[model samples]
Target: MIYIACGAILLALGLIWLIKPAKKANPLYGYSSYLAQVNQGSFAFAQKKASLYFALFGLLQLLLGVGIHLLKWDRYFLIWLLTFYFFILFPIVATEKSLKQFLIKRHELPADYVDPDKVKHEKTKGFRDRK
Candidate 1:
């Protein structure tokens, strides 16, 4: 039970740590720098890559957290708290962080942008659930 909780903490941190967003010199920088050069007009490529990883990482973290709770390892009250924290607080944090980053990058785009294939321009309003 405790092992699961510990694993949740470690997994969450591990996924977050997987993102390399710094300017530190390393092998990854060579590839990312090349990507930046290819996308010299904007930071879209870098941000897109980062956002993809963010979503994937968050999904994995959420899944692992849910799996832990489903095992019913409620041997102590502390486990319940940790479970609640991971299922509730952790998701909120992850979603909020992801949304903030998405918005930030999106807002930086050209104001004249348009996607003709998008349904947003249609009269139909899509359902959106609030987090």
Candidate 2:
């Protein structure tokens, strides 16, 4: 019951983040690691990547919960407790590791490097014209 509730909450939050990620590096919401908050590009990339990981983990957790319930493994409270903790912490660790790798790769590019996709997006949306 607890596992199912936690899983559902995580899945819902993941979907929400996926559908409407934070547009900027504000401390109020979204993935706010130092590397992710370093720049708009990093924040966007982290949000997308984090959402995918979260969604995937949440689904896994939901399935595990269902399996445990069906298998009558809930009696082993300690094991399930550890498993729950793992599921809770692993996603954040994985997201941060990926974000670090992304920032490293981005830094490897030339100082004047411009992301073509970002340029195309801005051009299409006219983001540069706004105040």
Candidate 3:
């Protein structure tokens, strides 16, 4: 019963995102990745990618959850947790990786863009180098 409920909630959230993904980066709302926050364009792209992948994976999770409950596999709680973890992580990682590749391919990322995650104090040039 609880498993089914959780699955339903996940499905609902995914549907909501599919209907209307967050447009901008906000601490309270959209996907707040540093790569996504680079600019409005990146923000929009990241949000769309994240929401799309999330909805897809979320649906998978819902089905898996239901299957678990139906099979009376309550002892496999760890499997459920692992599935949920991947469900949450897949979209975020995919979005960031996609955004990074897009920026690099287009050569649009700012020269001074400091990747705090990659480096400690290395300096960069600027933000959103349109050129």
Question: 1-131 in candidate 1: lDDT tens per residue?
Answer: 44445445544544543464434324543123332333333334444444444445445555655666587544554755555444334433444344444545756433444423453543445686433
lDDT of 2 by residue, 25-116 (tens): 76776777766777888889889988888888888888889998999988887877766867777778888778777877877423555543
Question: Where does model 2 exceed 4 Å of error?
Answer: 108-131
Local distance difference test scores for all models:
0.45, 0.77, 0.70
How well does model 1 score by local distance difference test? 0.45
Measured on C-alpha atoms, candidate 3 has an lDDT of 0.70
- Model 3 residue 18 CA deviation (Å) reads 3.1
Instruction: Report residue 107 deviation for candidate 1 (angstroms).
Output: 28
Give the winner by lDDT: 2 or 3.
2
Worst 10 residues of 1 by lDDT: 30-39
1-131 per-residue lDDT for model 3 (tens digits)? 44455556656666776677787666876677777777788877777777777677667767877787788897877766655666667766777778888778867776777664786554558864444
Clash pairs, candidate 2, are none
